[model samples]
Structure formats: C-alpha cells, structure tokens
Target chain A: MALEANYGMVGDFYTQNFTTTHTGDGDTLILNLGPQHPSTHGVLRVVVELDGEYVKKAEPVLGYIHRMHEKMGEVKTYLQYLPNMGRVDYLHALGWNWAYVGAVEKLMGIEVPERAEFIRVITCELNRISSHLLWWGAYLLDLGAFTPILYAFADRERIMDILQMVTGSRLTYCYYRFGGVSADIGEKFISDLRAFLAQFKARIPMFHELVTGNMILRGRCVDIGVLPVEMCRRYGATGPVLRGSGVAYDVRRFEPYSVYDQLDFDVPVGKAGDAMDRYDVRVAEMVQSVRIIEQALDKLPEGPFLNPDLPDRFIPEPGEVYYSVEGARGKIGVYIVSDGSPKPYRLKLRSPSFSNLSLFAELSQGTLLGDAISIMGSLDLVIPEIDR
Target chain B: MATLGQTIKSLWSMVVGMKVTGIEFFKPKLTVHYPRKEVDNLGTYRGHCDLVAREDDPLTPKCIMCGICVDNCPSGCLSLTMHVVGEGKPRPAGGAGELMLAQEVILPGSIKKAPPTGKAERVLDSFRLNYNYCSLCGLCVQNCPVSSLAWSREAYLVGRSRQEFEFDLLARLRAKAASSQGVKAA
Candidate 1:
C-alpha cells in the first residue's frame, strides 16, 4: 500500500512532494540516512533511493548547520572573522586560518617574517597529522572497529597537548593572526613536538599492522566506491581525495604557501581510486607530515612574530584574492573581495568537504548501502564545513 | 589449492592484526583514572579572560575603563559601564577606588586634567563578562593597553547555569581587595 498522507501538511511535504515516487508496484524504498546519524559525521541528511540493498539514486541535502559565514564576513571586520575560520573546519582549522590569512596578506602585500613562516609550517602540519589521526579512528569506527579510535585518541591527546601549548585551544584554534601567529612558540612547544614526533613514529607501524593489513578492512575497502581521477577533477576534489585517485596534486607542493616551498616533503599518491587506496594515501600522508614538521623545526629561524608595521585595525586595498591551502580533507580556499574597508566586501570559503561530498551522490550509485557508508567515511566530510 | 592458499593468506593477515592487539595488551594502559588523576596543563592553557590587578596595588585593576576591549570584542561578551564621579564627593578609598581618583580626565576640548573637585572622572562601574558567549580568542587580552586582561589559570571552572557564567569584574576586584587587606592586617 502507498503510505498516503495529506499533501498540504508540514511534515508530509517531503513524502508528498512531486518527484520520483515509488508506489507499491515499484519495490524501491526511499531512505533518509541522516541529519542526525553518527556516520554522516555531522548534521548531513542523505536521501537515498534504494533498490533492495543497493542504492539506485542518492541526493545529499545540506544547509542544516549553515551559519551564513559569507554574510558574517560582509558585516564583521577582518580581525573579527578570524574565529569563524577555525569553527568552519574544527579538524583542520589551521588550514582554513592559513587560507584566509594568506589571502589577506596577498591582497595587502604583507611580508610574513621568516620565523613566523616556519612557525606556520610546523603548527599547520602538526594540525594536519592530528586531523588525519582523528579521521583514521573515526573511519575505522564507521567500519565497526572501535578499539582503533581509542588508540587514535591516545595519540591525538598528546598532539592536542602540544598544540594547546602554542595555540591556546585544543579544537577550533584561532592561533594565526593577520600578519603572523597570535603568540610565539616557546621552548616547551618545540620540545613537546619533538617528543610527540618520536612517539608517533613508533606508533605508525602498529597502526598499519592493526588496521591497514587487516583482511576484513581490505575486503570492505579494496574494490568499493571507485572514484576516478576524471571524476575527482570534475568535482574539484583536492588533498587526500585527489591523491587517492592517483593525482599527486598537493597545494603545498604545487602552489607553495608560507614556508612549504622551503620544506621538503613528498606527496603520497594511491595507485587505485578505491576506499582502501584513500586510506593508504592518508596514512602515508601522516608520515610525510611528520617529515615536514622535522624539517621545519631544524630550519626554524629567529625574527619578530608579527609584522611591526601592520596596524591593529587593518584595512586592505580594494582588490580580490583567492588563497588555497592543502588541508587534511582537501584544498581549503578563501576568496576575499576587499573594498578598501575594514570589513570584507565579500568572503567566500571554498571548503574542501563541500566539493568532496558533492561527488558522493555520483559515486554511490549501484553500490551496496554498506559500501556507501564506507565511501562517506573515506571522504572525511566535516558537515559544518560542507554546510558553511 | 588456490582457494586454500587464499584462505591461509587471509588467516595470516588476521594473525597480523591480532599480534598488534596482543602487543598493546601487554603495553602500559593509556587511560587516565579521571577525577582521581589529572593531566598537567601548560602555561598556555587558556581557560577564561580575567582582569589583572596592578602589581603595586594588588586590589586595583590595571584597566583604565578605556573600553577598547569592550569595543574590540567580536562576540560582544564583554561589557562595562563608566561611572562619572560627581564634583566635591569624597573619592572611594582602596585599590580600584584610589585608581579612579588618580585617573586622568580628558575633556572634549583636548584638555587633560587630573582628578579633583568639579572634575568628572571615569571609573569602571561594573564590568560584565558573559563567559558563555566568550570564544576565549585572547583578542581582548592582547589589545589591553595597560595589560589589565590576562588568561585565568582556572582550568576547572564550571557553572550550573548560564547566569552563573556572567562574571562581574568590579565585584571580583573589590572582593580581591578586601581579602588582600585582611591578609595584610593579619
């Protein structure tokens, strides 16, 4: 029987709305996967048309957590908007912070000091490793391996301690200011980071042994949800997602922001564009992140943390600039239009999760409902970032 | 024979996974016994922004009631009312009150004058900080001219309700002043 409901009623609007309808004759079932489900990673609603266990069609309904950050940029001054960047992608906030700061600096032609550049490189890379660790744990949790996350958090807590020494806050960090970082990295920060690096290096082998080499994990991830390089390019997927598709296009390597050009780090690429390949790419990327941090620490220079000439209330010249940084998930771009005012004329955050999650509806077709969850996990969709 | 070999390889992979778990089992436990045990917080751990008292006079806050922090606060969590001391009234004694008397008065005509009778002085009446809305961005602390705002080391700060988080800086200053006076007297 057709589940009949009043067309005009508020709650029945989704069911009664004119679109693809599956009556009793057609056995296809329409399922709402979230807006609250733990696997969606945040408040993300995925409406999937299911043909038995396989997904026939899928559509992601966003804007549940949308705060209209673009509108906020128009209203708030440049300095006021810094906190919002961290809140956008809490996992890889430093990337977003770098993107926005880099854009403004480019627009205003501000030269960041040598010491500040090195600090940015070190802190941002550390944040990237922390983000990847969380993703590793959460993804494994989604795949029904709970203990890995406990181990992941154990390492993550130490990194957070190191980050907290410099950034002040553990999550949603607003460490980076207009010209440079808010505070200088002390001796404690450097020593803690070195200790963390040593311990993390020893832990990586065990992570590979426990999760990566597992037969069950390989079975679930190996041939499922293949995202081709062409599809990734079309969808504007960058970072690990693009690398997982065998594209070695890392923004740090290609564009070279802050002190990334000075640092030596290899971009890890996967051969096959499957979930397992994506997983391998991220795990490999973590090792590369550690290498980058070590190089940055060795080359750390001495200078003023913030630009002396930069005023407290900074107003950039009337121009437009788009700055992109390679975040944990993908490329985070901040496009700012300045009208020679303290407030931005228009600020648009080209968050990576938005672009990466856009390819999901296309990728999940004809795949088992279970595989769809794995694909979503691999994507590392920060829903607030997507909705922002 | 090929299928059997594949099964053997899968079993070996499972063993590899189990080996990792077994090693972890023997390793020292990472979990901390919460409430009983606590991790040490670094000096950089920012809890909440608190008003800093003057080094010379422990009771007096270094804040000049300039309202720069109040204006610059992005979240609008900080608020302070300026109390204008009426002419001929005896200046309130003690730290914050004494500082109010010493506060320089700037007239609209670009004239700077010291506090006396018939001269209106700006004093911090009540500094209200809504900690609930505070992002703890440290912008206010960084911007304070006299360095009156500092990150409080109160890491274990908790409140039952939203109203409890609304802190009155002036009252805190007064309480601090009284406590220090008691200590000095004793």
Candidate 2:
C-alpha cells in the first residue's frame, strides 16, 4: 500500500515500461534501500530498479519524518510558531529562524537595529559554518571515510559551545526574535568566537591536507553524480549544489539580506558539478563564512538585541510576505500570510533539501549503485527538513 | 591501467592523508566522557524552566499570577491553579481568564492575600509544568513580566515514568528555599 502510494501502480513495475503488469522478462532486480539506512541519513527511503549492478531507474519516497510543520503555522500564533522553524532544518536552524522572522519583519514593516543585524549576520554565519562542518563529516562518512567525521565533529563541538552561550540551546535554536536576536552577544562571546576563528583558520589548511587531497575520496567523487548547471537550474537546486555547478548565485550576494551587502566575501563556485566539486565548494565556502564573521565582529556595535519598543502581542498587519535566506544546504524560504490576527492565516516553508533531493531521481539513473549513493550524499540532505 | 605520474600522485596523496590522521591521533582527545565526569560548563546548558525566587524571601516567587507564561506557551505544557478572592475581575496587572478553581491547594505560607484593596485578587496555588510536553522554547522566560521565569541548570533530568516528568514548580521552589534556610540556621 505504501509502495502504491509512492508509485501509481506497484505491480506494474514502472511507469516508463509498458509490461502490462509485473512480468517484464525479469531482467531487473528491485531494491528497496531504506527509510532507516545509515547512508540515507535520517529516514529517507529510495526504491531503485537495478539492471545487474547499475541502477536503471530510481524513485525517492519521502514523508518518513513529516511533522506537518506548515499546518502548525496556521493554528499557532506568530510567536508560538517561531520555534517550529528551528526543527525544520536543524543543521541550519538559524537560517530558518532568519527566514521566518525576516518575512514577519517585512510584513509588519519592523526595522531591525544595525547592531542587531550585525549580530544576526555573525551568528547566522557561525551557524552556517557549523552546518557545513556536519555535512562535511556526514558526507564523508557516507562515502566510507570515517576519520573525516571525527575531525568534523571535533570542530562542530566548539561551534556548539560558542552558540550555546547565547542561544541557550545548542541545536534547534529559537534565538532570533522578530526585530532582533533574543540575547545580546557578550564580551566573552566576541573573544570566544575570535579565538575559534583564529584557531579554525589554521585548521582549514590541515583539512585540505587530510581529506581534500586524499586519492580514495577523489576516485569515489570525481565525475560521479555529474549534475550540470542546466540540470541544477531545471531542478531548482540552490546553495552549494548549484554553486558546485559553476553558478555564483547566492541569496547573500544576489539579493543581499540583512547586512550582507555591507560585508565583503566571495561566493565560492566550482567548475564541475560532481561530488568532488561540491566538496571543494563547501570547503571554500567555509573559509568565506569565517571571513564574513570576522568582518561582522570588527563592526559589531553595542545595542539592544531584542527591540524593547516592540509590543508583547506581536500581530502583523493583514498581508503576505515571502522571505528567503541562504542556508547551508541551499535557499531557505518562509512564506507567511497574516489576517491581522495573532495567528498566521497561512504559512509555507520552502526548504532547499527538498529541491536538492529532487534532482537525485534524475541524477541517479544509469549510475552504479555505489556512485548513486555518493550522489545522494553530495546533495547534503537533512530528511526532516526535506519531509517538513 | 593508470599512467605512472597518476599512480605516483595518488600514492603521495594517500601518504599525505595518513600523515594528517597520524598528527590528529597524537593530539589529546577532544571528546568529553560524560556521566563519569560531567561537562564542567553546565552554566550555559538550558535544561528546564523554574520560577525565580524573590531576593528578600526565597520562599516567595516573583510571578504576579499574570498567566502570560501559560498563554505564551506553544505546546500548552504549563497550567496554573489560582485561588481567587471576591468576584474575580481582572487584577492590578494582566490577570488570566475565568478558570475552574476546582480544588484548593493545601500548602500553607504559599498564599499571599491582597492588602485590603477590595478588588479581584488572585493567589497562585500551584504552577504545574509538564516538562514531558515542554519544548523549552524559552517563551515562559521571555514573556515573564516580573522577570521571575529562568532556565534551571538541571541538565540530567531523568525520570522513571511519564507521571514523574510532570513538575510542580512551586513545590520545587519551596523545597529549595527550605533547604537553604535549614543550612543557614544550622
């Protein structure tokens, strides 16, 4: 019944082939890779038809981790529904937080303080760095490389420590308020971040030495899961996935939100849209994120993190606004419609992992089973975000 | 099948990779063996919510019975039982809606009656927090008008059953106050 729900006719084998029902000479082997597989990374099931060792066709079945988050927005008040953003894309929870608040801020015409904007940029970039670090670890772990993940988590722990000091929660942070952040960055926050950055900058070269130049990674990744720029455009994939396809498009750069226009950093792009290219793009992007944070810290001003003037009962005027922020995976979007009531009339979350994972169905066709797995890993999918 | 140059480069890369791992392995371990020797910096760790006690009297909580925290909670985890005096209209501050004040609390010294105002006065009987359902979004702490709600550092909050997770925050505060008073008296 679940298979029937995923594919129109499960007994008929595939939509592409006209076999009149199950018996199509039995050349292909049907493989169900898992809603609980380690490589799928968080309850993502993909059913593929295999012609010997190569995948003939692939179908990705979603909704394993669905929490009905969009419906949650309609029932709950604006402030009440704010924490749902954190769980949507937990790796880049702050990005979702920014998108939701940014949308609400735009709808209500709420002005964020310059200092608050700077703080948002700093924390968001720090969060972006952390998200990328986890991806780097997890992606390599999927490709049968275990050591890189250990290094990745070691770096991630430091970021969690720095973020937990202010955000209160290490993961699923609901720290950013409508006009500004929940807590002000302390003196210790600045010093700790600066120390982490200085220490991290020296480690990037070591990462390049350790994982980037490894021959085994290169053999598995290079030219495997080759997603061209046009293919990425058709699939609507953004962030590093699209950037790895040699597009310099970034929400922070193209349509500069917050204080990204004020800050200077490069949008790292790659030549070939392969697993290796995405890996290189992410590593370079991490360097760029570090630069963005350092500059924001240098210009970090002193002010109220949360707007004191804002009313306790925050109700946006009857209108709709769509806000997009550059998350670590891709562009995170939040579309909110308010009816001048405390609760939102309608709310929609546009997660990048959904779009990035969409390309996998087309990209995995005719590839070896192992290479297809590598391609999926390259997408850096957070299943909860995709299923949300 | 590969060229000689390509093979040498691959071999060199593998060597470099091993060298990086070798260096990292020699460094002191970064992981914290928790539960044995707990993380030293539990100060920033946000575990659960607790009502902030008044500086003057530790037994007394600063909550004005405004019920902002209950109203602000998304998960509907927190519920307060209040004892109302006179015809219950709104209090001096933002008093909550008409509630079924079914059972009265037996705890003495917890109640504070209004000072001859002849107005609607609400006395907080119990502040029951179902931590099992609590999302720890910090809405209670942030919406607090009297600055009474705070994040407690009870990181290892383990329970045997679902009922054990249902926290009576007022009782916990009183126990903490009594313990401190006992220490001071001793």
Q: Could you say which candidate leads in DockQ?
A: 2
* TM-scores (chain A) of the candidates: 0.95, 0.95
lDDT of 2 by residue, B6-38 (tens): 999999998998999898778997887887777
Which runs of model 2 end up more than 4 angstroms from their true locations?
A1-24, B86-118
**Local error of candidate 1 at residue B74 (angstroms):** 1.0
Summed over model 2, clashes come to 0
What digit string (tens of lDDT, one per residue) describes model 1 on residues A149-263? 9889999999888899888899999898878889999898898899889989999998998878888898889989899999998999988888998999988899888888888
> In model 2, what lDDT does residue B120 have?
64
Residue B106 Cα positional deviation in candidate 1, in Å, after optimal superposition: 20
Model 1 global lDDT (CA atoms, 0 to 1): 0.83
DockQ versus reference, model 2: 0.41
TM-score of each: 0.90, 0.92
True contacts kept of 2: 0.66
Q: List-wise, what DockQ does each model earn?
A: 0.36, 0.41
